[model samples]
Target: MPRNVTTAVAGVVITVCAVAAGAGAAVPGKLGTRDGYEDAGGPVWYWPVWFPIFAVALAATGVFLATRPAVHRPAAAVAAVLAAQIAGRAVVGVRDWFNADGAGVVDMSQHELATVVTVAAGIALAGTVAACFAVALLWREPARGWAALRPRSLRLLVAGAVVAVGVPGVIALAGSDAIMLAGTVALTAALPWGGGLAAAAWLGPRARKVTVRTVLACAATTVLTFPVTMLYLMVSHGYDVTSLFS
Candidate 1:
């Protein structure tokens, strides 16, 4: 397949899977809720239908992980990290579900739940970074002539950052609390592609936009924001890094 074709296809697959996975997480929470509370006290993150989402997410993340890691190695690495993060979340959610009581309430307090999930996120982030690094160390050096930063490229990047930051900010400033939270969740899940969309807005030549560099840039910038988003969520919940455990 053409490199362009694979990159485009992979991006679309990741995007569709992202939306589907989110629905999987959310729909189950709504399945048997009472005023938004579920078996786990507050619609625990994982439920029976979560797999369908995970399966689709797995497919999206698998694209760059498969036979062409060398073609878009940065994207492959990002995909790996995304997969690990999702897996970690699923693990904690399922663990909590199994550990819940007869009343379907998890034994841990809300603070404890936050702390554990935060810890899990940290582990997932660190572990994936290490693994990607190891793989890069073993892989052959990439070919020379990486695209140079040009005037237009710099502008595109700046604009992209503005868009990436602006989307969530706009949602927060404009929406009600419930809407803001939902928008944030949906945006965060899009990750690198959200960044890519920023790039696409500027580089909209249907034939020429989806290059390796753009994809990697978008993936790198967007995924880096994940940590920031997590931090924001913690603060929004009125918990500090220390407070979660305190």
Candidate 2:
């Protein structure tokens, strides 16, 4: 099969799966519930159908890991890490579900929260994939190019990812909780791309190796953010008042 055709198929699959997962997360017939609530409990983070949404996200993540880079070498390790992250997320997600009694009433506003998290996850995932494609599609020498990123560059990228994803969120929450949700979506989408660029800069190479180390690293970067964001949601108030649009 032609590489472009293969990549196109993979991209389409990623999009469809992501959309399905995200759509699964949305609660139906709840338009009026979109408003922000102060003192909303953490249970809102784990909606009733949370598993399906996460399952779709996991499936899409796997599909991408499988199809990315289009190299001859096996991607077993990358696949493994992707699986691990999803498994970890599932464990945490289920734990949250159980802790909330699984039958507990979902906050009317949870649909809003789910929307925020799902969008953010999608963005981070998509951006990292785009970065991988940028390396794979443009530079045949991904190994050499990715492997050459300096420490300073990697540090800068890490910092940039934090700021780009964080500052907007902080500002958004301060203005309106509704905008805080939007901030989550924006952060989830952009930060991993920045991280992927850094991964491409350092782990990325200009040539083939036993593995596309940079792509794997970039995927890991994307997946790792889930837990980090969850922790943030856990610690910080669910509502942000400083968001601009709120």
Compared with the true structure, what per-residue lDDT tens digits does model 2 show for residues 90-124? 33343343333334334435554454445535533
Candidate 1 — which residues are off by over 4 angstroms? 1-43, 47-66, 73-119, 126-147, 151-159, 174-191, 197-246
Report the lDDT tens digits of candidate 1 across residue range 1-246.
565555545554454444444544543221133233243333323332223343354455445434454445454444443443354444444344434422444343444445445543443343334324323422333343343222235555665566556655666776577464534333433333344444333332431154324445434644665576566545433346887577
Q: For model 2, state the Cα shift of residue 38 in Å.
A: 31
For candidate 2, what is the total of clashing residue pairs? 30
For model 1, which pairs clash?
none
lDDT top scorer: 1
Residue 228's lDDT within candidate 1 is 64
- The numbered model that scores best in TM-score is 1
Candidate 2 residue runs with Cα over 4 Å from true position: 27-92, 102-152, 158-197, 200-246
Q: What value does the lDDT take at residue 129 in candidate 2?
A: 48
